[model samples]
Target: MTDDTPAGRSPSRRTLLKAGLGAAALPFASPAVHAAARDVKISMQRSSVLFTVLKVKGTLAERLAPLGFTPTWHLFTSVIEPMNAGAVDIHADVADAVPIFTQSARAPLTFFARERGSPAAEAIIVPADSPIRTVGDLKGRTVGVSRGSGSHYVLAAALKRAGLSFDDIRPAYLQAPEGAAAFEQGSLDAWSIWDPFLAFAEAKRPVRAIANGTGLTSYHRYYLVNDSFVAAHPKVVATVYQALVEAGQWVKANPEAAVALLTPVWGDLPPAVVAAANARRTYQVEPVERAQLGEQQAIADTFLEAKLIPRRIDATDVRIWTPPAVKG
Candidate 1:
């Protein structure tokens, strides 16, 4: 879908006001109240579509900054690295990553928000010259991934759909940047990753897409926050979600403008690549549906079956925002 949404154009004042009313409904506490509250920090991955919401001078920061909230951004090479470190209040990446943390005896995190569409953002790519034509070609070969991420789950489900398992192939656990370099070096056989990085690798290397997470995996992006953060500042939580949703809507309608914003944010990425990536995604933030939950929970079960996680988790408890409340 080509979205020629012009830049420098703002959504009408009426729309902004309605969004403000939505923001007003959020549980924002006064500064005096916030002063007495604990400070919470948020960590975001560098290349994930979620960054489109967090870019410097981006719509997300501009909207939330005025709300008396300060977001401290941490750039991790991969999603799971930040989550496992326990370094931030909320981790934003694929929704599937949440269950891995839940199943590991870690505290069950609250599901704050979700991207309406999967990342036109991530996919599995192979060298054009390679013999691999379909998912089945992955048998007995090494697939690179950053373990415990949406990309990780994408590969897991892809393998299962192909009548294969993690054991059928060698898993090279590496962060995305490293994985990209490995792919270019020909040391990595097949690589699965999220865009910007996926776009980056595909630009320099002649690659054939094996499969995207779209059909095989639930492409929902989730915000995972500690329970304390959710309980203490429900208002701030809603504010963040609203800003993200607005930004998402903007990106959906204006692919070219979205690419222009990302070009500087992503640092000189070709316009075509950014546009291509943006075109494949839907940016709305909403609660996960039950069917989406079951698909993701099945991934958690697969992780347990693969011994990637310590034990089985219920997966349902990770959801903090109920669907009814998400309906606007």
Candidate 2:
């Protein structure tokens, strides 16, 4: 699983062009012969604001068109299932902990890009009026969280920091909406989740954060591509990576504009809530480096100790694709 090439070194642009232009110069082909556009299926989730912006703006499709590729977008509640099923070519973004489970399942995915850690982005929150005022108070209380999510790791780390274990709390495995409903009904002691769900809940309800990933986890989100797709379409991968980089930059540079663009598609969440959620995120996309896998390894170990994932895995032992060098 180790790469012979130096870390951060990927196939060159020239090499990608050569690979993508296969049979274009066939001697027997007519002068008008052209390659049919291949479809690149991309998975999108509501929480991934950059991908949402790209989809709304048609940025990815426009970028891929010149490469003779057509972009096909698919929405998913959770992308890991489809990704493991090999149903998509690219996954827009997913929590840091997600890839670990995928890796344990031996999914053929390659990390291409990642947003920098935004520690405050995910948290464990309890009702503001609840007697549970701290992470330690949840020793025997019911906590809600999405299984195998970044917030799940946040809950685990927060519990461990408070000298508790996953067994200390009764976990209610639920999606964001379901967890929100349970929390509202006073059925759960605390709800562990990420923004804009976190932001939406805070704005809509009276909940106080007991602990976010601040001192525990980095909360880095990643972009991945199918390994088979990476091999057959290196140039397409590069294009998608660059587009994400640009999209990240755009989101950071124009916060108000970005929120305006995302409001409609984000389940019509309030602008203030969206902005608050975005403020907690760095939105700075960078190439995935092996050195950054330290937190990933920690996440894997945490999940393993909790018996969440199936088996142990070397988090760093995975494929990483570097984006092509930026042109002046």
Best model per TM-score:
2
lDDT, candidate 2, residue 238?
89
Clashing pairs in 1: 27-235, 121-195
lDDT for model 2 comes to 0.78
Q: Estimate each model's TM-score.
A: 0.79, 0.87
Q: What is the lDDT of residue 74 in candidate 2?
A: 64
Task: Give, for candidate 1, the lowest lDDT window spanning 10 residues.
Answer: 1-10
For residue 46, model 1's alpha carbon misses the true position, in angstroms, by: 2.3
Q: What is the lDDT of every predicted structure here?
A: 0.64, 0.78
lDDT of 2 by residue, 157-198 (tens): 888889999888899998766777777778899989888778
- Taking all chains together, the TM-score of candidate 2 against the true structure is 0.87
